[model samples]
Target chain A: MEFLSERARQKLKSALLILSFFVLWEVACLVFKVSEIVLPRPTVILGALWQFFPGIRPHLIQTLYTTLVGFALGVGIGVVIGAVIGVSRVAYDTAYPLLVGFSSIPKVAVVPIFVLWFGAGTTPAILTSMVICIFPIVVNVATGLATTEPELEDVLKALGAKKLDILWNVSLPRAMPYFFASLKVAITLAFVGTVLSETVASNRGIGNLMMIASSNFNVPLVFAGLFLLAGLGVALYVIFSLIERRVAGWAMRKQDFAMG
Target chain B: MMAAKPDTFVPALPPSAPERARPLISLEGAGITYGRGANAVEALTPTDLDIDKGDFVALVGPSGCGKSTILKLVANLIRASRGHVFVGGREVGAERVGIGMAFQNPTMLPWLRIRDNIMLPLKIVEPFRSEFRAKRKTEFRDRAEALLEVVGLKGFGDKYPWQLSGGMLQRANLCRALIHDPALLLLDEPFGALDQFTREELWAILQQLWMDRKPTVILVTHDLREAAYLATRVCVMSARPGRIVADDAVPFARPRTLDMTFEPEFVALTQRLRGLIVDARTGKV
Candidate 1:
């Protein structure tokens, strides 16, 4: 530990911290004689994950596909609607409160409506994911455009710039950092929307796998499914994070030092 | 509106000569009142001014004197409630004519590289706008580099705005404002955010740019010395519901330097303007 560099030390510390939690979980489960039906040991969950890996592959793929489709649509529509709302005061005043009200309805509750409308399958899952994830993107993009410095707008206007020119040259670029931030949040929520709908209405995906495993008292398999979903969420988050770094690294320059 | 035109004997000049010789920008009894009647607040009183072609004018007054409002009026960013604002002898229209602007903050797009930020205007304003896509990359690069060189940022165009110091950013800001070779430039306390040393340095930079191009410039500032040093004419505005109370012509010669601020006449002029602003602030006219 003493020989380790500072960054290595930090990584080691984090690893040890996470490792200690699992160690405590395994020991507590065994020592307390906790019923395996209620909670399985970390090793048992790992064993189940390996054993069920082949069977869970299709479910994992289905979940990932649905989430990605929904997220893509959410981002596409969010950008257009957000830009329209942000650019026009009349549209903003009219749409903002309605959006706020609509987003307030729990997306989980809407899953049943989606099910009734589309039946229990990928359609409901995708729509639910889109519904849950689009709000943050709209909020962020609209805020970015709405807050464009009036002075900057004046500069462009004085140059004979049309509304479209300002949006392309100034507003949209200004929204990138906000847009990327929303992507990170939206991607995570995309998973939630997918899984919630899958649990309620879909016959496929990890959500359905976990539900079936739980009913069969296969606690370890359920934990395995949860871990798989977490892994997928983390992988998607990291991909977006990498994209964010490449596209908008300049914005994070000051934040990097502060975070360190 | 009823003020009579003087009857003078005359005419060696062409009939349209007098009209042609009229100032490039004029606000004739132009004013702005925000909101509707009853609750409306008059931000600017009916004001009259004329800025000749290539003249450098500075508007100096208190915080709410509507000095910046006058800049906006000239740029046609806002309409005058009472009368007309004429640019190039025509009434100001919704469509913008050639005008460039810079503010106290650099207002550089953080996402854009310094060079691209400077090139933004050309990509929008026409003649250049229509050809920007077809022009060789090197042509745009050369123009940006030339402007950057003038601002002492020759090799730094690839850097982001965040990477530059405050003074360097302001330099880029000035370059962006001038990149289009506009007929008129509007500056709203362009150096107000910098420290004294940097502010003085930028004054020299701006002075050089103005000298080289001779665009019609209207600077709005609280710093009387900045107004006195940079402008050929300094106009003082009264506090709220602002109206110009004094329009003093600066007598300093061209290529003025920092040393000139210490000269007796420069000191006297700045002090006089300062006193006028104080009186304006106190509602004493």
Candidate 2:
């Protein structure tokens, strides 16, 4: 107990909470005599996952690959468009309304269009995820750059720095925390976009497997598919969080005291 | 030794020539107005002022007297609606070089280490910028470290801006401003947010930096005591449509100490500056 640091203790508490949640869920399913089709118990879901892991592995890889490819493209395009809109008044005024309008349309609605244009497979899934995740990244990056303190700009401007110099030295670096935050949001959205396309069009990926599982009334397998997706999402989120801590730790430290 | 031909030699100009002794900075009836037409509000009145090289001048008055506006004009951060601003014998334009500025808020880039933040200008301002990459590890880093030491932030170069206290950040802010050895230094109430003890401590640090480097400084502050303590000349401005109403030269010797602030002459000088501001605020000046 003495050897456990505060972070380790906190992590242990989280693990215990998750373990208890599953135990409670398992007990309720048994006591209520709930039908497996209606609500499969945690143990049953785990069993199905262990039994079908080999078959599920390819679908899992498909979804992960689709989401990552889409997310990387989304981040690259988002940052460029965001930097443009953030720095230029003309871009902000002309493009912002259009972007907002486009984002407001349900991403699910756009999946069929993507499938129609690209034909049913990985292409539609990748395209859907790319489109879905770009909005948050663009909005966040633009806001970050637009909100750069005038004082900071003045510090460089007084030294006769050119516009590009200011953008490179100050605006982009200042916008890093905002960019990283959007990565967390966009990463999750990327998964949603991929799955949406996969369920609607693709014959591959976890979403398609879950679709097939539900159609055959394989409740345990469906739950297992969900568990895999959730696990993958959490893994990606954790990776992004670690990267954020490394690059934008200054803003993170400020936020801790700010909350207090 | 061969004797130099008299025809090849050019005689030196007389010292009395106006061009020979022109001020480092000259505002020829310069003024600024916000917006245009019906919505326009005059911030600074058309006024003339001259500052010689290495002069420490403080602009002091009530709030809204546009003291900071004057500094911005000098830095060429904003354009004058009337007349011209000349710095280093050239009219102010889109491109202004050899200027360093610090505000009340310590505007250090949070992502950068203190040393990197101080060396920022070197990566942008020319001559140094041209050779920055080559000398960054040796010459530039040593300069940043030296300034940090001067500001009492020795060995804190690797720390982020947030890790330091408000006072320490402000001290770092001063180090950043002085690191480039700019021809002009503009400070807009840089210690305005600090506690009294911290503010007084910083005053000594700033004075030492200024005395050593001798960059022409224009400090904009509401603190009359600060104006008297640090400046060679204190210019008091009238409130609204700000104009220089009073310009008084401090009769104090160099290497001024904090203890000297308590002297009768220093006290009287600050009191007179305070009185000018009060009158300006009351519309009696």
Query: Candidate 1: which stretches are off by over 4 Å?
Result: A1-9, A255-260, B1-20, B94-96
User: lDDT per prediction?
Assistant: 0.88, 0.89
Model 2: per-residue Cα lDDT over B1-285, one tens digit each: 112233442333357766656677889899988898999999999989999889999999889888888888888878888987777656765224489999999988888888999999999998899999999999999999999998999999998888899999999999888888988899999999999999999999888888888899999997888888899999999999899999999889978888999999999888888888899999999
Q: Model 2 over residues A135-226: C-alpha lDDT tens digits?
A: 99999899988887899889888888889998888888789899999999999999999999999999999999999999999999999999
Per-model TM-score versus the true fold: 0.92, 0.93
Tens digit of per-residue lDDT, candidate 1, span A91-179: 89998898899899998889988889888999999998898788899999999888889899999988888889988888887788889
Stretches > 4 Å off in candidate 2: A1-4, A254-260, B1-20, B94-97
Task: Place model 2 in a CAPRI quality band.
Answer: medium
Residue B285 miss distance in model 1 (angstroms): 1.5
Worst 10 residues of 1 chain B by lDDT: B1-10
lDDT of 1 at B41: 98
Q: After superposition, how far is residue A90 of candidate 2 from its true place, in Å?
A: 2.1
lDDT of 2 at B52: 89
lDDT of 1: 0.88
Q: Which RMSD values do the candidates have, in order? A: 4.5, 5.6
